[model samples]
Structure formats: structure tokens, C-alpha cells
Target: MAKGWTFQSLIDEQMAVTAHCQTAPCHHRQVLDLVKLRDRFGPDAPAMEWDFKSKLKCSRCGGNKVGLIYTPDTSPTGYGKAKGG
Candidate 1:
């Protein structure tokens, strides 16, 4: 696999998180789980995003708002901690 490529475990995690969500009357916990999983797995898992929107709908309640919050692109700044005030 290429660098940054998503593994099957990420997909499995998404599935487990969304299984119950597939049914109506979804729960919020499931959505949170999905967000966490996606964050842990990163934006490389295709299984997580394969719907009409070509995106991974939130696992909690199937809402698109449920996504991993992204931090600013700091790779160019080097892998160092920020300076203290």
C-alpha cells in the first residue's frame, strides 16, 4: 500500500459505528464514534465515503455535519511544538 493509504481496520471501524445508524431512529453516540474513528484513520478510507454525496455521512445520525475536524496544515512548519507565551 502507498503512504497515507487507509487500511481495512478503518473501514471495519466505520461499519461497526454505522451498523445501527443504518436503521432509522439513529443515535448520537454512533455519530461521535464515526467522527473519532475517521479522525484516527484520517481521510483516506473510501468505504467511509461512498454515498450519493460521495462522502462519508456522519455515522451517528447519518448527518453530513459529523466529520473529523481538521487542524491547520502545519507540516510545512516542521513537527515541533508551538512556542509558549
Candidate 2:
């Protein structure tokens, strides 16, 4: 079973961009961007934290990027969605 997730926690974290960043030199910046994105979207509310956690490659580095991955309107179990669907 799964539970509903909200962006309250993420908002507290103050991330900017929601997605993971792969840029090596900017890894720290990536984190900052995520927080910034969150802040931009919701200065007091984030996009909502995913109920489940998943591992995704950094969009900039192409390697395993560690962090909380947010799935829109879906639970972590839904990560198996068909590719390019």
C-alpha cells in the first residue's frame, strides 16, 4: 500500500530545481538549484515530497545521483512506468 505525499518537507529544505543535477563541478550548485526551484515554486510550500524514494542518474553527470526524487501525482512504486510512454 502507499500513502499520499506532500511538498511540505521539501519546502522546509528550500530546494530550487526539483530534478537531480548531473553537472560535476556544479553538484553543490545542483542541490542549491533544487532548493531554489522549490523556493521559487513555493516560498512557503514545495512541489511536495514523493512518498517513496528512488535512485536516478544526475541529469548533468549521468551517474547515480543520490537524493530525494519527486514523482508527480504518483507514488514511488510507479517508477516502473513504460519508457517513452
Best-performing candidate as measured by lDDT: 2
* Poorest 10 consecutive residues by lDDT, candidate 2: 46-55
Superposed Cα deviation of residue 18, candidate 1 (Å): 2.9
lDDT of 2 by residue, 5-65 (tens): 3345544443233455445664622333444444555434423333222334566666554
lDDT of 1 by residue, 1-85 (tens): 3323243454443333332223345533332244554575555554333221234464545665432331222333565776554
**RMSD (CA, Å), each prediction:** 10.5, 12.1
Count residue pairs with overlapping backbones in model 2.
17
What TM-score does structure 1 among the candidates reach? 0.21
* Per-prediction TM-score: 0.21, 0.25
